[model samples]
Target: MATSPQTRKAIADSENALRDTLWTDAADRLWAHKTSGGFVTTPKTMPYVCRILDEMSKDHPLASTYEALWSYTWANNAFLRFNKPDDVTFAAGFSGQRGRRTLLERMRRLQLLGFIETQPNGNETFGFIFLPNPHAVLFRHQAGQGTPLPDPAPKGLSTHILPASWNAFVARALDLGCKDVKLLLNPPPPAPVSAAAPAVPAALTSPKVLRRRPKAAAKA
Candidate 1:
């Protein structure tokens, strides 16, 4: 579809903002691992984690790197962009260990949330974990949980969405965490089938009711 100038500009602006802030520093620091100890959750913790991720992306296995990347995508969304998926990743370099965390911690959080069962593989320093809301992970990467954003272009043959298209946008976002998603916006409630459904039925119209309750109660 032909993207309008306004929509293109907005998408471009958003892309620039994300790249400059999250991707730049993250790509540079992904591989620096921390084997001596775990992550320190201090006021300065973010920088340390970012550094480790920077090195890991380039050095770790593809699976490990993707995990770290997704992790960073989630945290970045929560911390920076207010809990939305960064759809720009479709174009932004998807490689890089932009996100990683202690495996014990990851497993604990996942188990606590009842997203998965816990098991040990006997790996130290960093254990692998399962994430149930991988789709939400995408949304957390692409879109946030706050008041949804306005789509720059109206959806037609192809485009993001039109202005004030919160429902469609949210539907797209929710699809990240849900499967076979279907969203109905402002759908009218089903109309009542009968204007007046007889409490006692039509009675004489049916022999069963005429035999059960007397006609007087039926009429009343």
Candidate 2:
């Protein structure tokens, strides 16, 4: 029996709708977690997220890696996920002979490019984290003036492992006039100083200068 074109179209539409709903649900959960401070480190803002997606989509070699990241994000219900590179590769739908190595290489490439960050999980496993440009516009719209920047992802969630080449990547991003995108590269602020600590004496705080007048007089 031949399936009618109308029936096929309906099925396709249904799949699309289902996928959209899943993505929306996942995003909502992540947003809720962020609001509740479940993520010690902040997830990338929507704008930054969108920008990263755009860049990854344009890179053919990174297509599978990008999909893997999306899957992990959905599975974790947040931007942080605890999984080995092999696990992520399998989750991305890569199977069969040689698929694992290929996927692992792709993951490494993404990390080298600064699209993803990873930290050790103590048991020889790794925790992967996504770093996208922050959504400054959305943040401003929702937070209004004087709003603090987003917090870093929780230490438990990600070690915030950065590659040694990260400096070069940041420099390139800034040179490209991508100030907003480069915001993610900045280090988090230091923890606030304790108010209970004793203050240093004013005299000790002042700069000291050595007098050279005696030496000059001796020379003359």
The top-ranked prediction according to lDDT is: 2
Candidate 2 lDDT for residue 220 = 96
**Model 2 RMSD, rounded to 1 decimal:** 18.4
Please identify model 2 stretches exceeding 4 Å from their true place: 1-60, 74-78, 84-87, 91-93, 123-125, 134-220
Where does the lowest 10-residue lDDT sum fall in candidate 1? 153-162
Give the TM-scores of the predictions, in the order they appear: 0.20, 0.33
- Predicted structure 2: lDDT: 0.50
| lDDT (Cα, tens digit) per residue for candidate 1, span 1-220 | 3356798889878886887686777646555436544332221222322233232223321233233333443333311121222332322234234422333333233233222333444543222334343333223323433222235411211111233343444444443322212222234689888787647646556977546877688799
Q: What is the lDDT of candidate 1?
A: 0.36
Residue range with the least summed lDDT across 10 consecutive positions in model 2: 153-162
